[model samples]
Target: MDKYRDRSNTLAKERLTRETDKQASQNMAQWLEEFEATKDRVSEIKRVKSRDEDRYYELLDELEITPEYDRYEIIKGYKRDVDALTKEWLKATTPAQRDSCVQAIIGLKSDMVRELMNTQQ
Candidate 1:
């Protein structure tokens, strides 16, 4: 009777583990799908002539960094630190300063794209 009880408990635990693993895999798949969708949307927005400023700001806000810095200063600092530690650039500067830098860089990049578009046109 003791052996039979132990065997049943082992089987039950195995079944539970299998179920948990399946659930975990399903959840991971769902998360990956969502991530891919988000990437696609970002790509589409970036391809537009007018990039989504709100979305860009939303991302900056999500990073918990303020968006208020001189574009050139931020670009200089970011370029210097990008290969090392981007988080440091965000950290060494004030929140508003950091935000300004980010906005400046984005604006610069957008201008460049616009120039390219005009050339192509």
Candidate 2:
């Protein structure tokens, strides 16, 4: 009777493992299907982002914005600091980092130059 019970337990364990693995496989398949379905939307968003970036860059090019023209040493220092921050922002993945960097470089809700030279010690 004990030997029979042990065999039954082993079979039960094997069956449970198989069922868990099967469920996991099904979940992965569903996830892949969902990802495939969103491909078009993802592509559209990426294209829009590319266009927007290109336009922003073109504006910068037309404006010829640079730090080299600033005559004051303090303003040049601010430009350098802002430039470094903007470079970090270009590589940032999170929205918060991007927003903060942009705000630091460009004044909030205004195209006018911000006073950052005084902040630097």
Candidate 3:
């Protein structure tokens, strides 16, 4: 009976881990999709003429809600920080060490962005 109970507990733990991993992957996929969509919008803004861009910014400012320009600035700053960290990690002594650092930094930045997006929504 004890052996059977132990086996059941092990199976339950494995199932929980698998479920957690599955949810994490799904969340990551959704986050990537949202990030890409935001990037495309920002790129579209850059493609517009300066006058048009200024007009757009003015309209957003007038709305008196969350400013699109400010949000874009935050996103850009986050991207720059991530890029710098990536470069620094790559210069590390060993490939394994560099990869570990890169992964950790990416995870931290990703969590920060996720939190920001959640609050804004």
The prediction achieving the highest TM-score against the true structure is 3
Candidate no. 1 TM-score: 0.26
lDDT of 3 at 68: 43
Best by lDDT: 3
- What are the models' TM-scores? 0.26, 0.29, 0.46
Worst 10 residues of 3 by lDDT: 16-25
Question: For model 3, how does the per-residue alpha-carbon lDDT over 1-121 read when each residue is reduced to its tens digit?
Answer: 9899778756754553344334434454444455566667656655664659786666545532544444545556666665565556645689787667556565655565565566466
Stronger candidate by TM-score (1 vs 2): 2
Kindly list the per-residue Cα lDDT of model 2 for residues 12-120, writing each as its tens digit: 4455334432443434234334434444434454566566977655544533333321213233344456556555765678989876766555442122122322222
Model 1 global lDDT (CA atoms, 0 to 1) = 0.43
**Error of model 1, residue 26, in angstroms:** 31
